[model samples]
Target: MIYELNKSHFYKVSHLLTGDLVNIEIKGVVQGYQPGWVFVEHIDHPKTAMIWSKAIDGFYFIGDENNTDFNDYINQFISLDIAPRAKDLGLISFEFSGTSLSWDKTLESVFQNRELHRSKQFTYKYKNIINASIAEIELQNGFEMMEVNVFLLEKKLSNLDFVTSMILDWWDSLDDFFVSGVGFCILYKDQIVSCCISSCVTDDAMGSHTVTLNDYRNHGLAKKLIHQFLTYCRDHGFEPNWDCMEENLGSRLLAESCGYTKDSEYILYHFKLY
Candidate 1:
């Protein structure tokens, strides 16, 4: 029988997570600051497990290979528990760690009748900002820099809805964000055009994310915002980590330019429930 692992037993599944963002979400869940679920085949001595982060729609699998019963249970859980809730979310993403990678085919079998897509994700760690001049870079005539805060969220700027949701959805509330996150943005004509923030935070490290309006893409605003982000990291004694799709040249280039070295790579599997 399947069991929903208690928060106190979360450590049993944690041994399988290696990604910074995954770790951050799991930590937040453990601290009651994030929403997630943990399932195991055996409550007291689980040999198979799955950790799901609600905010990110991510699943991390850890288990023995070819465990038909557990895999069957996962398939049922996806169809019943996950599909209804995740229909609004574009894709459900999955990762495997520890000995679970060997179960790739076993896991994929569960989604055999569905459309499955796979992509490589790279994780980066801070080396040193290559462009020391980033901080001194001046914006062109019409652009300005601003700090992101609750006041900005209160303003409800139509242009910033995406950024606002990115913060609130991940942190769940403004109070949690104020306690665990930091952010900055670039404004063009009083509208936010680009932003950088701690997408995930743990005690000693932060996962960085950047978003620039399509129209503002080539203007270097992302780099400037990242410089501010790195500044905050240095001041607060946090190590910065970046994760991006292997196919995203822009994100990969920005990380390389900013002295982030590729630390690891993993695969992300995506599939729709219905």
Candidate 2:
């Protein structure tokens, strides 16, 4: 029997789900910040065949899902009408991770009538970089890497518009990096121009985000923030990592400059709610 997991199971499952950026929100799930849920074949039993976690309009699946029971769990949950409620959000995506081979069969066994399209996304991992990384080259004419307090999440929240909203929404994960001084921002006389934060980190790989005020584009601030973020990863145990939709050339180039290359890609299955 498949059981819906409670927050208590977070610590055990978080590490397993974190390799992907969306799954890293497992931090919010464990911290009780939002309505996140996980389903597993066995409740208290160790090492069950499959586990599924519900993300906003999408879901993330992890575990050794090569077995038939994994397919059974999908049918069992959908039979309970999980589909209609999930699809009510319009369109939803399912992202699968890890070395599981039976995904095509498993999906076929369940959604025989639904239309699903497969798309690929790449995530880069750092390889063969020196011990210390330089955070900035020459600050461009208009911008400078201003000194921002590491623990001042509130000041940023009250001052900026877009970045503030993101920080407020995902405070738990951002706070983990904020308190550690793992990010930086550019300033131009009191108005925050560009900023970067270590978005998420696992034992092995670290994820990042960069933003700049609209008027401040082409000022080389994004790279400066990224270089700083990568440097922190160098000193720490985590590998500098980046991931984006396959179409985002800007993100791809940014990662390339830091000596990172495309390491792994995942398939995203998109389904319409109609």
Candidate 3:
């Protein structure tokens, strides 16, 4: 029998299950945070089943427990009329200690390369790396200080705007990094100028992060915003993570400039949904 999970219970249990890898510190309608949801499985006994949460509906379980049965769970909780169709699901991990690292066969297949291996030297460098050129633009007359807002939720896809929707999509598609926080633009005269989203996760094992905007390109806003987020993460016990498609020159240059060493490589997979 599936028991309804409350906010307090889900928060407590998710931390216990993932060993604090998942955090529920933002405010939202649900018990956790945006784009991520947690559930406890009671197979045979409610206490014995593994606890699982998905950030951006991409990967279902992290830190080991049988994920083979996730489809069954999806079928059980999601109904055509009540839930969004299952788009994709998979697993990914990063090791920050070395240049060589080994990923699962599934990851290699997703990246479409067979030479990817798990070693200290291979793990810290990003495979299929991409670098992007930085554009410089002067701020308007009303630009001011930067700020960050972190929200916790108990459900998925809460009241998000158009830009937030794109950010969530990007987070779902990218496996080498994870969303660390969302940032809003500040104006010199106290008016809002732009907004950006940032992430924290490793490529192979090296820490990195990135920030992106909607229509505010060609400005140095992203660089400053990402730096603020990185500083926050570092101060809060998280190592920054950065990675991108091999062809994404803009992202690569940004990461490298921010002191992210291209240490290792890995693969990202998208499962076909029927």
- Root-mean-square deviation (CA) per prediction: 3.9, 4.3, 11.0
Error of 2 at 227 (Å): 0.1
Each candidate's TM vs. the true structure?
0.78, 0.76, 0.46
Runs with alpha carbons beyond 4 Å of true place in candidate 3: 1-35, 39-55, 63-142, 148-193, 197-216, 234-237, 262-265
Instruction: Find the number of clashing residue pairs for candidate 3.
Output: 54
| lDDT per residue (tens digit) for residues 17-99 in model 3 | 33222212111112333344434454222331222324333332322233334323533343331133333343333111111
Query: Which pairs clash in model 1?
Result: none
Give the per-residue lDDT digits (tens) of candidate 2, residues 55-133.
3344555654454455556655654545566666443544443333355455544666667677666878777544655
Clash count for candidate 2 is 0
lDDT value, residue 265 of candidate 3: 51
Error of 1 at 2 (Å): 2.3
lDDT per residue for candidate 1 within 1-274, as digits (tens), equals 5788887677775555543334455555544556677888877777677767777767766656466657778777877776666666655434433223555666567767767788787879885533233345678889988888877776646677867777866777767777788998888875888988777786777777788889889888888888888878877777788878899997899898886789877667776566
The lDDT of each candidate is 0.71, 0.58, 0.38
The candidates, ranked best first by lDDT, are 1, 2, 3
Could you tell me the TM-score of candidate 3?
0.46
